[model samples]
Target: MNAHNIDIALVGAGMGSESCLTKEVKNLIDNADIVFGAARLSNSFGDSDRQNVIDTYRVNDMIEKLEEADKDIKAVFIYSGDSGFYSGAEAAYLRVKEWAEEKKKENADLNVNIEIKAGISSVSYLASRIGISWQDAKLYSLHGREYKGRVPEVIESARYNEKTFVLLSGASDVIRLTDEILNIKNVILYLGYHLSYDDEEVMTITSDKKEEFLKGEIKEGLYTAFIQNVSPETKYLSYGIPTEEYIREENVPITKEEVREIVLSKLRLFRGCTFYDIGGGTGGVTVDVAKISPDIKVISIEKRPERTELIRKNIDKFGLRNVTPLTGNATETLALFDENNLVKNDNEYENYVREIIKNNPPDRVFIGGTEGQFRDIIRELKKFGRKIRVCMTAVTLETRNEILKLADEDTVDDLSVVEVNISKLVRLGKQHMMKAENGILVATFQL
Candidate 1:
């Protein structure tokens, strides 16, 4: 053991099999003084002494072991799959690099070297085995993490992209996702089980066999999947989804496409923000905001049950996963969203409601139909005690005046208003005439 130097290698073991190991990674493992990985990865190399291999993939545990070493050491941390592709190798490398730098600063004579080796990712391996090019596929991972709207995001991705590749946790996840995929038309599901092992299996489920396949049992193991959308929808780069594209009823009012565009712009949405679409009539505004990003959590609150159902239909038509439609009065719903209200109920339904309210607080808000509860809703929003950007539309003078009155309140800032009037050309017996719609007042403020 030398006293002055330490060398570390962060290696990607590749697809849980010896055959998938890269030559460089194999060589590093062969000569490593100490190895760190999960038991499966460590067991793959039979020749390596068990005493020198730590059966743990956590970076902190590996670092602690290294710190206890009395002499200079060559340490290797093995991660499954490509180091760069959603593997623990990246985090291990970063943490080790930071640790080494700090150690060098404390001891002038110490020398530390760190290197990262990449390996075959499951995406590429599965794609190769099935004779498909993965360059066109959109990749997502659900391994060992909780992702909000996981199914919906995947479904939406499959709709827009020709192929959607997902790295899943286990058998249950595969079944759950497959069940959702079965609802989509003209899509093929390619399921890979225990990839790269001797018993590796891949099954292709088409629309024809989906019903039969869903009823059968699924083998439990690490899984990777691909959904091929035969007729992928065209991707739209900007927001304002046309009004005709939505499922609208004559009675339930929808924010017009023109007004939606202006209101969304005024709200100043950003990624991962929580948005409250209070009085989400037909969910037009809710869907538009949700389309901005899957990370953006849009909760659509509607007072009428029929309108809430209509909002849900529009959500389904658009294949949006990030919008949560709740049926209740806007102000009353806001009151129920409090954590105190959550503690009062212990039922499964209340638990589900608790998760949503506890996790997402409004970062931005859109008040579409207040039903004469405008001031009450504003008061509820103010209770959050955080800066919130608000945008609302008013077709009545009373609502417009209510918005203006906020300027006098100390809690509100940057209050501004704009009136939008739009006209469309309609065909009247071979002649086109401009038809005017009611003007809407768009108000924006910060709270």
Candidate 2:
């Protein structure tokens, strides 16, 4: 088990060229007995011998090679961009450190030293090239990962922050993101292609010209994007969105603004919690809750297909990607979501529901309309055996009585009720008058 002293250095190669390498990194590469990195990074250093330079970016493969190599050697692992910013350097460092720790435990005399060198990140390079500060920008990377939810997340980040920087994989990611960006207004996309290389190209396009830009050809390679939103929506800081702001059908029922504020307050939402808006009519409550945090997954279930379509439209209008609309009876949907009945079926929506529920069960549940199956829905939720906060709004006396009856149930706890009465100012012939809307009773409790 005895091993010789080992010096492991995880170095950042900066942008894609030799000129971007820090002087210290260059010295490490020059003096190291062996080097490990992608072919592009390892070959960039002309002085390093090809025999000593191992062309492999996989962390495990690098570790395996290091283990098989001779002891008492100075080994360097090169990573593209800054080692700390969404680069593989972090993983390589951790894995090597773990290996060194285990080896040292077996052999006390073995000297293992691991160090990480910070290189200029693409964000910093692009920002400097464009004459902008990156400290105020939000950074994200879609490289070597699933990007299904990331497009909306980056778009939402741009809407809230003045600048957003995203490290993309290739032309596919760029096209997908730009297609969504075209729907937004007042935001500009700055794309950096093959940054720091001889053929590096930087293109700036505003939201208006995104269509034409997408129509033309985009060379595929390493890419990074910077989004500048002139007007960030600061109003999302508060929960209550005016009902008039939503695109609503005259026949569909929408939750009142005042009532939604009370319901959201009672729900006490947190980041990354799964929320279910059962009986979502116009999706007013779903939209408000989803805005609270992009991490929150809001599932709006409506029985009527028309109402579900309206919810989708509202989600699009607000540029929100976290809300998923399910069209079916609320009680039936609850049954499908039950722990025992959840099976991956051919239905895409059902499978999606199962995945979300299985991974992140409902932390918060809001029932605006129960369709007279209120008790059945509560019973199904209780089967999950997790602490869930439930909020319900009742406009009719029967529905109010049904909610009140839940207080006596063994599954319910911390029950509280509040009646919200809203009145609007109206103009009569020569004077203003107060008009009263329907009274809503809001009930909140724990399950």
Candidate 3:
């Protein structure tokens, strides 16, 4: 159990600098019989010949080489950045634990003696470089090799956290990520490229006219990152917030608060659900879904830019991060993720969203402003699965008939209908009177 007699040592290589390494970690590397890490990383120790330092870019290859060594050999694994972050230390530890557990059964005297040393992470380094505290930041990595498919989830994380710290892989990804983020107004970007090295540079840009500034600074194959500064929104976990909390304007409509509560309930959203708000005018229902959980991906689709602006304004006012406004017709925007149409294209945002659709798909879809394309939109959503949740609200008798026409025994499961009518208090001189609001019929299906 003694660290000094450790048979396996994992050391953190802070920003690939020998001077930044801890004295204890340096001593471990100097006294160890073998060292393992990526070629570029392990080469930092090339000046020292007292130990046999093995280098490989792949983690599996590193483990295989480590296992091939003598059973009693003292080895050290070096990972760049803080080993506590997404530095692949957990995976390596699990693999080593499995090896040690299996080895103990075969050999009577074999015990895995492992020790970990902390190092500076990119998040900490960037925070120091930008003079900002990362104590309130959410940590994420786009540099994962195995979990590469989940890279698009970075946008999802940025939606809820006031500060999001992302580890970049290359310029392509950084551009794609920042472009997707710029879709939402009020987000300020702080980028740190080649952090802690001689060519290191830190840049900041507010939302106003940032595309050209970003273009001039981006270069391929650089160690890059971006910190999103957002206003933190308090989640109203107690039922729902009052109607006046959201921004409202003329020509842009929103669902009534009472109907919105029942609509979200019918959606049956669980953890990590992708909720689509078609005809998402003013984002009233969007906020209702997002306030419940930060992990949900809520997309508000509207045709008019003015109404889209209302949604954005509402997003900023409520400090909601998970809700995004897409300014396109629902029929067209939803088609972009269609399985047949979404091959590969220049639109990185579309491609990124398509990947999420392929992996998670929409768990719940709300049709509030279908704009007479309700049948087409539902058909596209049906492509995801037959057993998905679809909730639609009709405010008029004519629109209610259209919703009923889309329902059938073959397409609907556990189908049900509910009507919500609300009356508000109004002041008339010295007395209060009840003013009736328009009623909405909520149609939901297990399909």
| TM-score, per-candidate, Cα-based | 0.93, 0.93, 0.70
Can you write out model 2's per-residue Cα lDDT over 1-447, one digit (the tens) per residue? 555878888999898698999999988888888888888888776345444888888888877876775468888889989989998887777888888888777779888899999888999999998999988788999998778766667878888888999999999999998888757777889999999999998999987788899999999899999998888777457778999999989889998898888899999999888999998999999999988878888999899999999999999888898887888887777777676787687889877766666666689999989878888899888877889999999999899988777767665899998888899999999999899999989889999
Better of 1 and 3 by lDDT: 1
Off by over 4 Å in 3: 1-6, 46-48, 103-111, 122-136, 142-166, 169-253, 281-283, 286-294, 299-360, 369-383, 398-416, 427-432
Candidate 1 residues 249-301, lDDT tens each?
88888899989899988998998799999888888899988887777888998
CA displacement after TM-score superposition, residue 445 of candidate 2 (Å):
1.5
Worst 10 residues of 2 by lDDT: 42-51
TM-score rank, highest first? 2, 1, 3
User: What residue pairs are clashing in model 3?
Assistant: 159-321, 388-447
lDDT of each: 0.84, 0.86, 0.73
**C-alpha RMSD values across all candidates:** 2.3, 2.2, 6.2
In candidate 3, position 43 carries an lDDT of 70
> How many clashes would you count in candidate 1?
0
Error of model 3, residue 285, in angstroms: 2.9
